[model samples]
Target: MALLVDELMTKQPRPLGRSLILCASALSVALVTGCTSDSGGPSASASSPGQQQKSPSNGSDLTDEKLGKQVEKTLDTAEVSDSDPLFVEAGLERVGDGFHSVPDLTRGHSYKLSVVCVGKGKISLSIAVKNPVRQTLDCDGVTFRQHLTSSAAAIKIDGDGMPGATGMVGWRLDKADK
Candidate 1:
């Protein structure tokens, strides 16, 4: 009986030890994930003592309304004549969320594209269907313009925000006459 008891005790330790290790690993993963995950929402604007608080691009706090207005103002600033055929698309998005505008463009045609953003961090702009043209724009409430000839049957404009970026992003794409 003593021999049987000793054998059972020895056999129990392996499974018991493995269960403990698995539990510990799961707990560690849960803790780490909880500590590092973002809530995907706007954070409160607060500053610690003696820390300089930076203002947003439009001389005001960032909001969906403000972002829309900024984009509208940017689109209006384009130099398109009133009678020219124009295609425009704009949006207000989170800083890290990407935005895109896909428009059917004539092949071998000329057009002017204007993009703008008001927020923190840099936005990556990519244009064209194949072999896309890419550029980075600083989110400083400034409009960027580019003129290009269409190489594909359609044009796609994408803006991606960099990691750990804050504030709102806005853009406008104006399809111009040939």
Candidate 2:
């Protein structure tokens, strides 16, 4: 049995360390802006220390811009530089889901996908490309990244926020380092 298990492991070496690295990066970003329980409002603690706290949405007082800035920083940290010639899409939903599409991608080219979500509830994301990828993010906020080789002309991102989910979601796709 041990030999059989070893054979299987050799056949398919798990990306155990890669997964840990991703989780660590996410946690580090989340730590920068503490997370709070969803109570139908944004918490000042969620804002970066020393910065003016702003709610994601407050009727006349919309704060999506503020969250976008934070997500930008997260993306930059992940090496998805804004200066890069790439497809970038980001936005905030007061409540419910969000969607974005990037067309005219170079098929078969390697690309890096970076995503970050901040706010409340669970944000389920579906990246539809030649090879569809799905991920669930805690609205508390964190940056997650993945590498993919394009197999389609376009990529669609569908962020389905679980019931009562409210937050900002940002994504970037850039040419991966060879």
TM of each candidate vs. truth = 0.53, 0.55
lDDT of each: 0.69, 0.66
Tens digits of lDDT, candidate 2, 44-108: 45455555545456542355656666676776643444665654434444325475656456778
Model 2 worst lDDT run, 10 consecutive residues: 87-96
Model 2 TM-score relative to the real fold: 0.55
Query: Which sections of candidate 1 miss by over 4 Å?
Result: 1-62, 77-84, 129-131
Candidate 1's residue-wise lDDT over 1-178, tens digit each? 9999988888745788999999999999999887655433245233445544555545444475676566667667434454655655556666677787776666777667777777678888888755668898888878788886777467777888887555556665556664
Q: Clash number for model 1? A: 0
Positional deviation of residue 121's Cα in model 2 after best superposition, in angstroms: 0.6
lDDT of 2 at 103: 42
Error of 2 at 146 (Å): 1.9
